[model samples]
Target: MENKKIILIVLATLIIGAGLGWLIKPTEDKTNEISENHSLESLDHQEIWTCSMHPQIRQSEPGACPICGMELIPLKKEDLGADPDSYQMSENAMKLANITSEIVGMGNASKELRLNGKIQVDERNAYSQSTHIPGRVESLSINFTGEKVSRGQTLAMVYSPELVTAQEELLQAASIKESQPELFEAAKEKLKNWKIGNTQIDRILANGKAIQRFPIGADVNGIVTEKMVELGDYVERGMPIYEISDLSKVWVLFDLYESELAWVKEGSKISYTVNSLPGETFEGTISFIDPIINSQTRVASARVEVNNKDGRLKPEMFVSGIIKNDNTDNDTQELVIPKSAVLWTGKRSVVYIKETVDGRSSFKLREIVLGPGLGDSYVVEEGLNSGEEIVTNGTFTVDAAVQLSGRPSMMSPREKETQKTNKFISVTLSEKEKQQFEPILSDYLEFKDALVADDFSSAKKLVIILDKRVKMLKTSELKEESAKIWGTFQKELIKSTQSMISSNDLQEMRNNFDELSETTIGMVNSFKLTSKELFVLHCPMANSNKGAFWLSESSDVKNPYYGSAMLTCGEVKSTLK
Candidate 1:
């Protein structure tokens, strides 16, 4: 009975343990499945990191940038849309570069014009002191230049024989006043002609003596600038004895360049300070602006009149001033940007416009028709609107990035259509000539792309291929008329190709590229391309703003002239179909 009971206990225990194990196994499997799903969800949310200094660096995980070795930050999630015109920068990059922008609007704009000037004597206030009587200077009270003299103060005592004769005639005339009234009046007039005061004549008549010495008095109150006479020197009538200038009112003359003329105007307010007078400020108005620009100096003088009654401002003292002009004229109020935002190349002024592309800030380099320059800023005549945002600082930094990306910037003005005269000649070509010319055109394109990338070494290598291809053309296959055209085109091609081969300088290469492009276009027009359509692109900012043209396989403009400075500064003019 005991053995049977033990067996029943064992069977019951086994059955209960099996039930508990089955329930726990399903719960553990469900927990493991949930954890695996969570891991997959986290993987889907992974971020891509990029460097601020180097926009080209992109990575899936956070780390240092390969190019600049800067800490990488998470790149904002957005579609990497292809827009060749715009240079996209991540928010992290903008922050790293300290880039900032403002929504430009039509408003009153002002610029602080810092100019260097010098204090000068007002030419209108300058005076020349002359002697009225021919005499010998007996003694001079004004001994040296810079001596201050008041009006009516005696500058010198002179002995004049003419004055003595006049006095003698006056005395004789006084005695014969009843006999000859006209003679007495003539003698008094003679004395007056010599600047003899009536008081001195009365003293002579009262004392009954002929005066030997005459007093020369100052006509104006001023500091002597030039002493023309010495003690005991012989003087002629109407000869200047001294040059004096009133410094109470001084002029601060500033040099304004021809480009700066638009902002400076007569009656503009000026605040200035002289190096000689530290910690003191003086204010004045621009009294004169020379209308004529100096051809040699390319500058004009802007004069400011300041009161120097306290004598703090000295002549020839160096001064610095700020010219304040309202610059709120109708034309100027259209649009304006800070000078720091503009990159000027000859006549072309360019600014980088910030555009939002797929939630990222992208900069597009745009050429603007500039109006008057208002000191630290420029008036925008064209190419921008009221609400557009532009780079106010770190302009060069953004341009550098554009260059690396092969886009346009300041050094490269955007492209425009070529003139009708610059167009390729419309001449048909024989099959053999077409075959010979097309390869050369292709090589020329390669050379152009090398230059666009600013790879001088690669450009040099491609130029060799261009030279070889040009020489490979055969003149025998064409008829007389076709051969002549071929000869002309070949000569231009060889000349331009040779010019490129001879120079290692990137700038010179770009210069030669202009001629190369023109000749290639002519060749392609004469004998059409068999493979792809060619684009005749022109950059208005190239070749010192005179503009230049180049050929490319794609419609996109890659300016060889500016290279990295303005990588994308051109546009497609027409296609060689």
Candidate 2:
């Protein structure tokens, strides 16, 4: 009876344990299944963080950017079904990007060209006060640089022996009127040829004494621009004693840039002001437009005739003026935007357009055809429509983000892919090649670090190491495209090193590092990896020729060969041992 009772207890305990295990197992499985589903949802809605200044910097989690070290912001996905290349910024994003918009329409529009000019003497009325007879300056009446003088006013007294002789001949001719009529006439004409007035000749004859000196008079009623002679100074015949200009009418010379030439013409009205006379507004009519442009400044001169009866306008005084072109009849308007809206890539011009739908925003980069540029703005000839919003202030930051997102951008993504792939191939280098390439990369890193520190000595030492490594590479596994790439890189490195050795300019050295990084990245891109398993060791900072590492999937993106940056940001093919 005791054995049977123990067996019954064991059976009952086993039954209870089995029931408990079955009940808890389903709960555990359901909890695990819920956890897995949550993880999948999180993966689907993962957020990407990017920097405003360095767009190529992307982090799976929110943090600061590695390139510019700026705080990263979330990149929101657009719901507007916009083009994949387009980015729409929310109201907040627009504010952060400093995006602004303006409505463009057809209307009669004219540009006001502000020109810088100076008060100049009317060249047409300028004359030199010169003496006809060779003589010594007995007295100078005009002594200052800007003294006013009148027509026929005595500017200087010149004493000449030639004039005295001519006067004596005239007196002798006057006494012998009938005996030698031709001789008398010839002598009188000779005295007149010496510029002696009739009154002076009559005085000499009446006094019965020859005068050795004559007064040099100004030819025009004007101011003395230059005084060339002083009292007691000897002057040659026909030499100018003073430079006189008629200031009653002066010229305001306006320097017009090449673009302003189309609107400016002869007889166009202009309004001008001088800093010295603030309240007094001066007006003039354009009388002349210079046919030739100044080569150095690419500016053409426009001469405006101004009345200067008061003599307030002086030569060489700086003047500012405006020329208004009338476009009232044309009725055609041009699309214009701020000059800051355009991005110049040396070869191509670009602008970022924001597309908004249902209050959501995205950005799209558009290539623009720009016409004549006005002050602070550019006339849009094509690429943009009547209504488009553009990011004026923070386009560079946006482009940086576009590059880091592994999307097609203004820069070639394929080139970046090629660089990344070639870096992976570089890992399969022969032991000797590795030895040669290792030191080169190490030196490049040192140079980059030194540059960041602004340390010249350490940078120079690293540059020398790179120079030596490149020289060694000239004889090693350098062949085909790799050889060409390394050869070009070596040449640039040598040039940069030479620049550093010759000059102590830190900026120059930094520029050399930029070139070196570019060349090395190109060298890395020239090689292809036959085996996917092999990977190259690369320094993100040292390898970047354009100065930033960019994450991209397209091989066509601009790499070191085409852009300013060398290193590409993307998934690592294999970890560096």
* CA lDDT of each prediction against the hidden true structure: 0.79, 0.67
Candidate 2 regions with alpha-carbon error over 4 angstroms: 1-82, 103-109, 326-329, 357-359, 410-577
Query: How far is each candidate from the true structure, as Cα RMSD in Å?
Result: 9.8, 13.6
Q: Taking the tens digit of each residue's C-alpha lDDT, what string does model 1 give over 520-570?
A: 776676666545777788776566655777888787656778776766666
Off by over 4 Å in 1: 1-81, 84-89, 97-102, 165-188, 202-209, 246-254, 274-283, 294-298, 304-319, 330-332, 344-349, 353-364, 406-577
lDDT of candidate model 2 versus the reference = 0.67
Give the least accurate 10-residue stretch of model 2, judged by summed lDDT.
550-559
lDDT score of residue 381 within candidate 1: 81
Sliding window of 10 residues with minimal summed lDDT for model 1: 76-85
Say which candidate scores most in TM-score.
Answer: 1
Q: Can you give the lDDT of residue 42 in candidate 1?
A: 81
lDDT of 1 at 169: 91
